[model samples]
Target: MATATRRSSRLSSLAESISSSAGSTQTPNSRKRKQSPVATPSTPPQKRQRPAKLPAATPTPSAVGLMAHATSATKKPTNPMVARLADPQTTNATLLSPETSRVITHMNVAAIPSRLPQPSTTTATLLEEANAHLIKVDERMRPLVENNFCRVFSPEGLAEAIDPFESLASGIISQQVSGAAAKSIKAKFVALFEGDRRFPHPSDVAPLPIERLRTAGLSQRKAEYIKGLAEKFVSGELSAQMLNDARYEEVLRHLIAVRGLGKWSVEMFACFGLKRMDVFSLGDLGVQRGMAAFVGKDVAKLKNKGGKWKYMSEKEMLELSEKFAPYRSLFMWYMWRVEETDISTME
Candidate 1:
């Protein structure tokens, strides 16, 4: 009985200890038992880092009254493309305010230097060759060719590059008419045909009735001249290629054989149109005057000094051209332009 009582007393002591420990683990005021205090790390409690402050979003007003008032005051958007085109000078005024347009007067100018596209191979070669000839004449015939025509003539480009077929036709039309009258008649002729086809092929132009052409614009005589030349071209009697290779004298002889085609017409064709360099038609009055002006002497005195050929005759022109050699055509252009200038100044 003593041993059993001792074991019962030990059991009661162990039960009492477990109950007290369980009571401590509960909340002190309310819970039946308390929880043990958990041991934390020795490091201080890590405070969570607050996210970096962000920009606050605009608050949408919940009041319907406020939103309705704002919507009523809003302006409609303008057509921006229409606005840009309507004010074409907008780019110029980028530095200025539209409200201050009336006050702005000075313009800002921007300048850039640009080169034209490179020329084709054929054109470049032709220019180089033509320039070589011009330079040769410039070296040898400096006094006559380059002095006066120095400003007017160019080897690589023409004064009339387009269908300036009319230059020859113009001299024909300008034969007796005043230049102004000839130009007016020419304008009518141009309008009668379309812009570029005014100078159609000879065979094509020849079939048209002469009177019809005159009514369109040419005079009876100019019409006759053009018709005669056209018929000649159609018949192969006066091929233009004659000027390319024939002796200067032979070409002139053949041209003058035609009723109305004079030495001057032939000269103009050979020199300016065909770009023949050997021609100098002394039968032309301008040539006479230009020669006289060059030496600062009287054409009358020049005529008197005649030995074999020294005046404004075909023979004399040839001799003078021999001295000027390779550049007579260039001299002719300048002579004409110079005469026009003198005439203008005198008038």
Candidate 2:
């Protein structure tokens, strides 16, 4: 009985110790549970409500309204060409603004530099090679040649007519005028020299009065241009020998110095007058029109404004013409022919 009583008492003590320890551990956890319910209800609801308001604040606007706002906030164009067109000098300003014209003119000069490879093919060899190349690149040229409708031939008489002065005078006379009118003016100009000369020698012309030159249907500006060209010849700044001997670019440097002889004018003189095989002019209207027609697209539909067609950019035109290097002048002549007889009919 004594042993059994001792065992029962020890068991009762162990149960009491376990029950106390359990109560101690439960006390802090019960307190935390009470606080968390209140805190979570306040903070959790506030966080959810803030996010809901953010989505509501972002109102979706129409595309047109957004575009209008963007346009109004934007600055005006800084490009000189665009600015000139938008606010032209005169109300009756044509499609090409003066500033745009100047920019394009300079752009052509820079893009298509007056440089070409030395003419390697002789007059005898030029025909065969040029014809072969042309036929290979454009088969349309073959039928015309075969039918005798056109002939691709090299220009003659370069060495005999190396007089830069007379050539520059011709260029000045041809400016902004029709070919027939330019020829008429040139005839009148040649007649002024007297002695039944084919054209006025620089020595005879350099001494003539500006008014005397005006009789040749030349504007006062054109008269001045011719007189200046004559003076250069007389002063030996421009010599026929230099023109004959100089490289293509050197010739350009001397000729371009004369006020009225632009790059296009010099190129024409080089290609046709001097019979240079490699000369080209990206700025020439005939060349541009011919290229557009050759490509089977009307230039009038390209980058048009105010019912006028803008010329192709110099880089684009030069890129097209680059394949004909060292014999481009012949190709240019052919292009002019293509323009005259529509390219579509050639095939």
Candidate 3:
């Protein structure tokens, strides 16, 4: 009976200790626990919130834009030709012929100043400088300089003293003809002008019949070409002063419009007539042959795709000639000599 009573007392003490521990651990609001609300057919779901975007970055300046800015900052002076053309009185469209007007309208104003010749220097000084430059730059040119003296700058060699009209007329007559034949025809043509005027004036030539021009060994087409050239001169569309003062390219644009005056003819005029220094004629057979010989290229072996013999090509000739610039006219004069003489033999 005493053991049963003691067991009941211990059980009561254990139950009281457990109750006190649970009461000490519980929160003051434990009786009011919060619950998440369930979604119903009548209720809408909440949307998610996103982070805000940052601002865009600025771009760096481009090369072209920088170039444009620099160009504007350092403005170039206006070309004299451009300034002259800008004047209504100077470049009157109504006063100009259709051809002249067209040429003027299409002119590259920015390029005019660069193309114009600088102030004249003595021909002897020019030749001396060119000779030294060519010999120093190219070993092949050494023998050519030693063997031949450049006479293109000499009074007798230059056409500066000759009438521009006569020079141009001579060029037209010489086309497609041998040197001897050309000289003969030019003599006959000048002889038609009667008493001692050297050569007929443009005014005189303009009115003459094409049949009269043909009497001097000219073809029908050549006769027409000369007559048309004369008319251009007579009309004041072309003049000696204009040609003398104009840039090399300007002279080309003006003359190439005339009949029988192609790029080759204009190049000859620039070289021999105006005595321009830096001119090259890729079309001249003599130049082609000379260039081939100079570079040790055998024309027979240098054939095109068709296997036909070809001389130095225009591209190759241009690339080679670039080394002798500012004196290429003198270089071209020597090329003619290369054909007549064996330059390789000379020390």
Candidate 4:
């Protein structure tokens, strides 16, 4: 009975100790705490801070003027020459005709300046005026003008003028041959006619046998060309009086249609025969060499490649010649002088 009683007490004591140990390990706030709803005064939502506005930009007077110019309803020029002249940057060259421009473009010529200088009242004569203007524009031209004296306007120079037929025929004969050889051939050609005339009339030449013309040192093709030119003259398709009164463009149009009369030939006739003032020929090798020399280019290096030069182009030639406008023929004469060549021999 005593053992039973002891076992029951020990069991009771062990059960109590386990219960107390578990209670000791338990957290004081085992349940989750509820969040408090504090009644603090609610602040108004903060507004976004705006950036300060910048002041409007004021345009400068020059900018305003440019804007006005841009908006203006001014009429623009239709012609290229006129348009170039309207530009303030353009300062030299005469206004070329459409025909002239076409030829230049076809030849790959340099650009000519569009604006011509106003005529000076200080000079007495046209030649004098041209001289003064050329000197004023290019100082290099002073020595050329002073030394050469522009005999092209003098009576002695004018006295050397031949008729249109002679001039053209002479040009044809002179093609691809030395000056002395051409003179020799021309002498022989003139001898073929019975009359004492300096040159044979186109009427007399039109009916001559090609074989007979060949006896005068003319190539078979050249003979045909000469005959064709004669026939045109005989048919009244070309006339001296008409050519004399026509403008340079008209002259170019008329002569360019003739057989064997190339642009270079026509240009030569205009410069030496017609005495046209504003004409220039980039095809002339003498002129090219002279121009090359004038601009400080090495003349020996200016080799002819195909139809163009090694150093200078036709376009460059035109640009270089632009400053001597309205008197390019005279300028060409002086260019020959620059090379120390006799311009008369070229004729």
Off by over 4 Å in 1: 1-153, 158-167, 193-198, 296-320, 332-347
What 10-residue stretch in candidate 2 is worst by lDDT?
85-94
lDDT tens readout by residue for model 4, 1-347: 12222322232233333444448553322332444454546955455434243221111111111211100111121322211111111112121111111111111112333374443321124466667767887999988898887654332333232356655666677665655676688789889987644467788889999999999999998798888888877787776655545667887888889987666556656665554567787656557667878889876554545633434677888998888887787788788678554344333
TM-score of each: 0.47, 0.53, 0.57, 0.57
| Model 3: number of backbone collisions | 0
| Full-model lDDT for every candidate | 0.41, 0.49, 0.55, 0.55
lDDT of 2 by residue, 64-142 (tens): 1111110111122223121111100111011111111111111111233359443344433444566677677767667
lDDT of 1 by residue, 80-199 (tens): 111111011111111111111121222211111236443222211322333355456445334434454331123222211212123334455555444466557766765655544334
After superposing all C-alphas onto the true structure, candidate 2 shows an RMSD in angstroms of 36.1
Candidate 3, poorest ten consecutive residues by summed lDDT: 56-65
TM-score for predicted model 2 compared with the true structure: 0.53
Q: In candidate 3, how many Å is residue 71 off?
A: 48
Off by over 4 Å in 2: 1-120, 137-152, 155-164, 176-188, 194-196, 215-217, 296-303, 306-313, 341-347
Candidate 4 Cα errors over 4 Å, as ranges: 1-124, 178-180, 297-308, 341-344
Give one digit per residue, the lDDT tens place, for model 3 in 1-347: 12212222232233333444448564322343334667897898645433232221110011111111111111222221231112101111111122221122323334458668633333324466678888888988999999998554542232113345555666666655544676688678877889844456688789999999999998898788878988888897887656655666777889889987666556656665556677777766556667888888764354444532246677988998888987787788788677542221110
- The deviation in Å at residue 238 for candidate 3 is 2.1
